[model samples]
Target: MTTRAFCLEPEQLDWCARLRTLAAERFRPLAEHGADGRLNRPLLAALGTERGLLDRVFPPDGTAASALDLCLLRESLAHGCTEAETALALQGLGGSPLAQFGTAGQRERWLPGIAGGRTVVGFALSEPGAGSDAAALELAATPDGGGGWRLTGTKTWISNAPYADVYTVFARTGEAAGARGVTAFLVPGDRAGLTGEPLEMLSPHPIGTLRFDEVPVTAADVLGEPGAGFGVAMRTLNLFRPSVGAFAVGMAQSALEAALAHADRRTAFGGRLRDMQSVAHQLAEMATRTEAARLLVHAAAAAYDRGDDGIARRAAMAKLLATETAQYVVDTAVQIHGATALQRGHPLEHLYREVRAPRIYEGATEVQRSIIAKELYR
Candidate 1:
């Protein structure tokens, strides 16, 4: 348990352990005080104030981490508090395009809020009809002819939607089919005709649906080449997919630990649960799968960091295996703990809710298979 994951150096292990301590001692209290299924400003402020984590999300040079470093940060934070890890992850997700592609003024306006944990940022890409099939998104961006555009569409299931300070929005700006018509825009939350309502969801955080009724934007808001925004979106997802797996790995590890602790303590049939062959075998399965998932996550992250070919395939594999494994591990942990784990306030219960969504979001399990298959033939 003391050794760093993936054979990380001692200093790295120590930092992760420190993050876990912070999560249990500081972050957990803040998380507990926040409203369920809503933005937690105080928790965010706490994260912003934590210089070590804040810097991880926004490095001093204002550049982002390699995929491996991102995985480490996410895995460590998730081990302690999934809520804290998610907040940090969302900041990176929503702020990524801005940090990498925004105009100087755009970055100046929003980056500080993001880095300081004072601003919530949204990645507004998914639409009601088009999700995994991102290229088919139909949010229209009509040209106003004066170098601006009027956006008139709805984006659903966006994280941090209503409350975000700014959004990295993708809208269709051309008649070309598929991803060609899309463009990325930096849209401020306060823009005219832009509104949102929170969506009650299985996984808690700040998730909502956004309406852009002629929301106005100028050329200044464009994130990249006018019609190439899909690339921007894909690149961002590619960078994050491995870290998402890392998050899953952390959750699995947490579940395994809980199960191990319970198995050693809970007696059944005149012996501890750990002594029972069935329980021991289940534990073995969970631990082995979790370890294998972690290796896939790290390898995928390393592939991204190296800028290697077939990155899409690698990322898909990582996310696919790790999330599925997490679902199994967490479920097994709950089974081992029995009814106590099902209580609303129980850690396993919370994890049970949290673990189910990663399979559906980002990219579904089926979608990952398609990506891998396409790569295989290509």
Candidate 2:
């Protein structure tokens, strides 16, 4: 009998270890040359070819989707090659709406390119005025008096923007207040009136701003129901947000391992650092917290895969705890390793930069807390 490869239980350890090896030995080298947030096409192509990860993101016609597998892949990749992990995650995020709700023709045109890793995809939602408050979005998609709409507005801090071959865009179509007024569209990069420029940000993620100057789109471009796009957006976020926490747990685990190794080897005051009570206790705390965060992430992912009704609160809690724990763990690792950890090329230095952004992106820690509170009261 064949084993279930993507199980949430301990049996998946071998699979996770294999992924870790690939990330460190193969993906990390390619990620090093990614050039500060530009589209790393070559790197993506390589990952797509390795272990068939690309196929999983944009699966074939009838295969079932599995959230647990998605979380497992993200956590394993982030442990060694965070850039590659982020690239894969963004593909899943941008392509998912169409995978779930796009017209038949729309899916036929984009899914193949995405699965082959030959196409870059972007999620265009956040605007200058609607960062955390997504319901306040103002990107206009006015009816063209026929069966289409004219998009006119701007989207900022979009992941994989400008350079992405396609975008899953959310724009305002109805006059209702809050999220009810929104609609989602599938817009190709070559659309005449659409243009964008990259933003210089702290994280080396391919984030930018998009301008839509009356870009024309037809009824065929609509994703799901015209005025119910917020539901589509939220459904996608519910699945991906727990996996974001998985990414954080991976980084925290990596930091904890590095600290443990350093403590066992580096001698201080006539003995190894591990012999010191204070240092030993800190290591214990880091390990304990990392494990706890990982468990929360796993439970959340499993709940999503099971289609559990409580997934929103669980996802928010997982992302909030795991991201905050990663920041603390990585910071503590830097402290434990002394000044050398801050050197430019050090892995810890790279992690120090990478860890802060997840807390803010894909719904900030504050946003996650609010979501949990709302779900609780409901």
Candidate 3:
């Protein structure tokens, strides 16, 4: 039998440790002081300019960061501060299409602000009717006689919406049906007739709904070709999905650590909680599942960096296992901690809220399973 061991190099491990320290010492304070459910410009500027982490996503050399690098970045930061992790991830997600497909003028105009963290960008794809079925987006982009388009529709559940400096907006252009007719545009948030309002979400990240009333966009604003936006979206998602799993793995690891620590110290019936069979077994399960999810996330990211075949299936599996595992581990940790875990400011409580969204965003657990199945048969 051949045994394959998955592991990170000593240097890579050290880098991750440094990232955790940076998040705790530098980013967390800013995140705490910032308003709830809103963008924190100071925290973003630190991640972008001070730490230069955003440069890894939109490098000046035009070389994209490896998928493994992105996964490591997300996981390490998530372990120390989920808010910081979320901010960094949102920057990368919103700006990646521009980096990958924008014209030179677009890149020159927007890349600097994005890297400096002065600009907030949103990926406006999910409409009220098209959250999971993205191809079913109903936002319309009617053509004008002068090589321009007028957008008129709504996009909900958009991160950094209303406050974003710009948005990568997708709208139906009538070239065909479903995804075939969709187009992506780089629309400024201040563009005429563009408006939005913040949403009060469970997770405290800045999410909102955008309403467009015939917002004008010229041909120069298009990302890639007009009818090729879906490909742009898919490529961006493929690169990001594994990192999302990495985020979940980090949260699971944090919860597992808390469970282990609590088990060792807390007193119960005649002894410490670790002495109890039920508590011990629960800790073991949490540890085992967390480790499993971490390894799977790493494997998927490695596959993506290598440009291996069946990336879609691997990415979906990684996200499915890791996010689900995070939810389970966090819930079990909360149970072990008893009433204290449910307190308003408890770490586990915050984690419990944060862990639920990953399974729904990017792609849901059900969606991931479907992708895996389709890929297997293909």
Top lDDT model: 3
At residue 85, candidate 2 shows an lDDT of 92
Q: For residues 245-321, what per-residue lDDT tens digits would candidate 1 score against the true structure?
A: 99999999999999999999999899999999999999999999999999899889888878899999999999999
Rank all candidate structures by their TM-score, best first, as comma-separated numbers: 3, 1, 2
TM-score of each: 0.96, 0.96, 0.98
Residue 23 lDDT in candidate 2:
93
Q: Report the C-alpha lDDT of model 3 over 1-378, residue by residue, as the tens digit.
A: 998688999999999999999988988888889888888999999999887998888888878768899999999999989999999889899999999999999999999999888899999999999988989999999998899999999999999988999999988988988889989899999999999999998866799999999999999999999988988888889889999999998999888888889889999888999999998999989989988988888999899888899999999999999999999999999999999999988889989989999999998999999999999999
Provide the lDDT at 206 for model 3.
90
Clashes of 1: 0
Candidate 2 runs further than 4 Å off: 1-7
**Tens-digit lDDT track for model 2 on 288-336?**
9998888888888888878888899999999999999999999999999
lDDT of each: 0.89, 0.89, 0.92
Lowest lDDT 10-residue stretch of candidate 3:
56-65
